[model samples]
Target: MAVRRIGLTGGIGSGKSTVAGLLVAQGAVLVDTDAIARSIALPGGIAMPALEAAFGPGVIDPAGGLDRAAMRQIVFADAGAKARLESILHPLIGAETQRQAAAAGEDAVVVFDVPLLVESGRWRAIVDRVLVVDATEETQLKRVIARSGWAPEAVKAVIAQQAPRRARRAAADAVIYNESLTLEELAQQVRGFWERWAKSSTR
Candidate 1:
């Protein structure tokens, strides 16, 4: 049976994770593409063989998992490198995302929590609705720096690599402005979003 799939997305530190959690509490089946990607790049995982074959040992950590830091540096510095890495991972991610969504069964309201949904171009066609968790670049920088201890330039680079804030908003069917809202307030908004887009749609 065809399911109602929601593409939930946001830039780094936009509090997308919190929205995802709240949606799960509202009973959405969350198929997190990033989590799937990370798992497949782990030691002895499906994507590891291809990653090793393509990028070689230097991109592999001593524990046999992907050296994400090295891979990020390579990808950011070269568009071709980014494309090469995505070519390897995107197919794997799509397949796993499908597998997980299928496993959710016929009645599930599946949310595809994809951070790179807008950048990917294909996700808009794949899901029923696109929901963006939005924050200003300044807020994103402050939050990520506080949480991850990444330098401002590092966060800026990451933000630059993603779809622009305006672009993300344009891609969205619904937008959650997450910059200054409290958790309970955010949860309240998510509840409203859930009632309208997810739970009601399932009916």
Candidate 2:
């Protein structure tokens, strides 16, 4: 049985991670792009040298790992800087994600949890289905601000970098409304999706 790869995405604070967790509990293999990105930016990771060259040594912590907060501020404040960082990191992350997915082997329904799936465009071709977790923009803003203690303006800035909710929804093959559901309810939805996916893919 070939693997069924699903791309899981949502705007910041839209509870995509929560949905990923639900899928994991249902026995899906999960690969998180953020985690892979962090791994690649760590001291001895393949992308660290390019990151250091692009951002200078100051972006590296005393412990030699990437100072994620410092790097975040730099990229978030400058569009060119963000693009440079992405240019360095994105390819590495994508390659590593594919490596991980392949290693998961056949028979696993692998879920690639990528925050910018719709924005990237490339991801659509790689995955069997795009599952978007969604919430109102107001809810997204409020949640990010509350959790991160970011100013409303900062939260909005992050939101601006993401594809609009309508665009994301339009691109999605499946949508999970995450704003009002309890974890139990979310788990049920994941289980239902899994059952259907399993039956269809096998046929």
Candidate 3:
């Protein structure tokens, strides 16, 4: 079968990562952009040269990798700096994403686990379906605090920056309501999707 490209997204505290893992276990090739970005920003990675050229050695650590903490602080404080960083990283990430997807072969179903799929405005045109993991804001805040030790305000800020739940739902071809499901229950939901996905792709 031809590859079914799925754009998966959710807010910070939603179980989107968990859902991605489930999909991977079901034989999906997961192309995670954030993971690719981190790998490329590591010492000697492809993005470092341009990144360093743009931001200078100040953003590079003693170990030669991008000083993620310093860079995070810089981007957080300056929107232009954030845009500059994105300008350096997005193309590299896009290239890598394409390479990985192509290499997944014709038979593999590729799930692009993009955190900002809805905000990007371009992903919708590429992917066959957008699967959004939905959760209430309160549920999101509590889950993030429990999992990451982030303060409530920090969680709130992260959620505030993401496309709203309504917008994400509007963009989704399917929605997985993840507010209160157990891991096993969520897996069941994913299993159902997998069954339908196989049949849908052949149509």
Root-mean-square deviation of every model: 1.8, 2.0, 2.2
Error of 2 at 90 (Å): 1.1
lDDT of 2 by residue, 93-185 (tens): 988898999998776789999999999989888988889999998999999988989899888878989999999999998899888888889
The TM-scores, one per candidate, come to: 0.96, 0.92, 0.91
Per-candidate Cα lDDT values, in order, are 0.91, 0.87, 0.89
The full ranking of all candidates by lDDT, starting with the best, is 1, 3, 2
Reference-based lDDT, residue 27, model 3? 79
* Superior by lDDT: candidate 1 or candidate 2: 1
- lDDT of the structure predicted as candidate 1: 0.91
Residue pairs with backbone overlap in model 3? none
TM-score, candidate number 2:
0.92
Worst 10 residues of 1 by lDDT: 194-203
Task: Choose 1 or 3, whichever is better by lDDT.
Answer: 1
Pairs of residues clashing in candidate 2: none
Q: Rank the candidates by TM-score, best first.
A: 1, 2, 3
- Residue 194 CA displacement from its true place in model 3, Å: 1.1
